[model samples]
Structure formats: structure tokens, C-alpha cells
Target: MEKGIIFDIRHFSTHDGPGIRTTVFFKGCPLRCIWCHNPESQKLEPEAINRTKKLDGQEFEVKEILGRYISTDEVIKEIETQVSIFDESNGGVTFSGGEPLMQPRFLLELLKRCREHDIHTAVDTCGFAAPELFRSILPYTNLFLYDLKIIKSDKHKYYTAQPNEIILNNLSMLNQLGASVMVRVPLIPGITDDEENLLAIKEIVKGNNSIKRLDLLPYHHMAKDKYRRLNLPFELEDLEAYKNERLKEIELMFSDLEMPISIGG
Candidate 1:
């Protein structure tokens, strides 16, 4: 049986996809982006972390396990429970991660099962997988929430610990395959929101019909506490989210693109 390590299964999520979605967060990733929001999703195995809890005005630490392995059948059963919700809202299941591609077989199995139940399937990915892996899951995936950050190779490697070549190539391949993709960019204050990087991204999506939308997600400090609990460093600890004025300016940079542009997904 194919089982994938899963950390979370978020139901009634409007941010992950169209309408209300049930997002299955797979555990594991290949890249190490310094500004990752879900730091807990990076590890492939189940692990314990210290979480601070408060009760009756007193604070204490609590130990919590973060990930688990579950079979496709088990996951499908959960998705089945949301069928009525999916049918009414045109929403369905989203396989998110660390990076869903890290557990290709497990993700593929879940996607196949979702298709069998007539559930709309989307994969939220970092595009750091082999070409063949994308091809294998293409048929099963109805939409892709693709993340692209820092186009320059050196900067990309420095921040994400991975090259942008594979990411860019796979995106191009998807465009050629006519896959429905919504490119999502993390607008880190100084790292990814620069004029050069935004212009470069604009060029890539300018004429691509496969890319249906572009979501500019501003950086936030919501995961600071999570990092503290996990004993992980928060590199952008002092960084702030983009102001409305600046976001408007950035949005104008891609106004000429054929796809829909929004501030958040």
C-alpha cells in the first residue's frame, strides 16, 4: 500500500482553491526556502516539537507530533465526506505540501482516487521535481497552484537551496502540455519583490495561455511562533509585509498579462 506522510488536512479552505477546498498537506519537500510559512511541513517523517500553551493565566510547554503516514484509501475516505460540499461550491481537494511532488506515488494515488469520485483536483507545488513526475500527475491534476520565487539562479539557490533551472523548465513543459496553472509568487519584502525579479516573472507569463492566473502573496510573520516551537530559525524575523501602495505598484507591473492578477490566492 502506498502511504504518504501527511501533516494537515485543512477543510473549508477558501485560499487554497476555488470556493471551499479540502487541502491535504503532504509532509516533505526538496527545497529549503528561507521564508517558508509552513516550516513544519518540510520534514518527511513524523517528529515531536515543543509548543507553548497557556491555561488559567499560566503558561506551559506541550509536546506535539507533526506528521503521520496514511494510505490513499484512508485519505480518500476523508475527501468522500466532503462530496456534498464540493458539489455545491465547485470546490474539491488540493494536495499541498512541503511539496506534493516529494511523495509522487502517494500523491498520484490520492489524485487518481479523487478522480474516481469526480472530485476536482488541484496540486499546490514548488515545481522542484523531475520532468517525468510532472508528466505522470498531469492527467490527474485539474489545476496547479505553482510557486515561483527568485528567478536568478544564485539568488534562488541561496534562499531556496535549489536551482531555478528545473523549476523554470517544468513550468515551460506545463505550458506546452496545456496544463491549467496559476503561478503563485511569494512577495518577500526585499528578496522576491524587486523590480528585476518581478519583471522577469512578467516576461515568463506574458504569453502563456496555460497559466490562468497569477497570485502575489505578500510575506507575513504568522509562522514566527511555529519556528520558535520547532527550534528553527526565522530568517526574515524583522521583515514586514508589503504595504498597499507598494502592492498596487507591483500589480501594475503585470497588468499587461493575459491572465487574471490578484493580490492573494
Candidate 2:
């Protein structure tokens, strides 16, 4: 009985994948993307987040613990409760993170259980895991919400605290394996949204037939408060969210690729 630490289990999430989904956000991550929205999920162990909220006219402070260690069977039971909803909307389970691949064995077992019950499964990954670990779950995954931040190796390392080599290599391998993947680009202002980076990303997806679609996700400030609660610095505090016109312009750049392109998720 293997158990893994999880920070959150977001139920009925539509933005993560097709249909309704229960996104199991596994704790722990490899990259330290400065703009990460879920700062609490970055750590592998459970952590207490101190928060203050105003009620009536007084401000009260509380310590909220994030992350729970649960076995595969426990997770499966929760998924089974939503089985009817999944059947109704072609939705199932989505393994997200910090990085689900961080806990390969736990993720593998969860995916296997999903398959045994005929659930449609999706893996929302940063694509920074070992090739062998990724290959092991291929047979159980129906769709992959793959993320591609910065294409340049140096810039990627500077922003994410990890090189792009492993991420790119893993994506290319996913294509070669004929896996169904949707390339999700986090349109961070000035970083990933620059024309130079967009073109580089285009170069990588230009001939990848295995890729089903591309999604451009604009940056948001929702994580600002999360950082405050966790006592972590919000690096992109001065940056503004992407405007509609700017997002439209980026979407047009990928038009020539002849692949379906969508803005946001």
C-alpha cells in the first residue's frame, strides 16, 4: 500500500482538461517557476500556511495546513464517488501537481486504478521527468496537458530554476510515442509571451504530428495572495496580466501551424 502526499484535490475542474475533472494536485515539484500560482504545492511535505482574514470588523489569523498523505485506495474511492459524473460528461481524473511525475510510483498506481474502472484519464505535467517514468504511464493516460514555458535553455533555467533540455526531450519523445498531448503555454508577460520565445515554441511544434492542440494561458495575479499566506515572495508582483489584444496577437502567430489554437487553458 503506497501513499503519496497531495496538496489539493480540485473537483469539477474544467480548465485542466476535457469535460469535468477531479485534478489531484500532487505535492512536490522539480522546477521553481517564479510565477507559479500554487506555491503551497511546491514542497513535498505538508506545510502550515498562516493566513489572516477580516470578518465583520475584526481581522482574525489562522493557520491552515496544506497537503495530505493518502494511499492509492483512498484516492480511488474518492474518484469512484464521481464516477457517475465522469460518465455523464466524458470526464474522469486528472493528475496534476507541483508535478505528478515527482511521485511516479504513486501516480502509476492511481492511473492503473483509473484504467481498471474504465475512467478517462489525463496527466497535467511540466514534462520534466525521466523518460522511463513517463513511458511507464503512457498506456494508462488518455490525454496529456503538457506545459511548455520558455523554449530557450538559458532563459528557462533563469525563470524556472531548471533547464529546458529534459522538458523538451520528454515532449519530443511523447510525440514519437504517438501520445495524445495538448501543448499548454503559460503566457507570462515579457518572459514566455515575447515574440522570440513564441517563435521558438513554434519551431518545436511545427512538425509534431502527435500534438493534438495548443493552448495559450495568460498570466494572472491570483497567486499574489497565495504567496502572502505562504510567506513567499511574489516575483511577478509588478507585472500585469496579458491583455486580450496581446493574447490575440500571439494566437495568430500559431495560425500558420495549421493546428487548433485556443486562448486560456
Residue 88 lDDT, candidate 2, scale 0-100: 90
Global Cα RMSD, each model:
1.1, 1.2
How much lDDT does each candidate structure score?
A: 0.90, 0.90
lDDT tens digits, residue span 188-217, model 1: 888999999999998888767789899999
TM-scores for all candidates: the values are 0.97, 0.97
| Lowest lDDT block of 10, candidate 2 | 223-232
Candidate 2 RMSD computed on C-alpha atoms after optimal superposition onto the true structure: 1.2
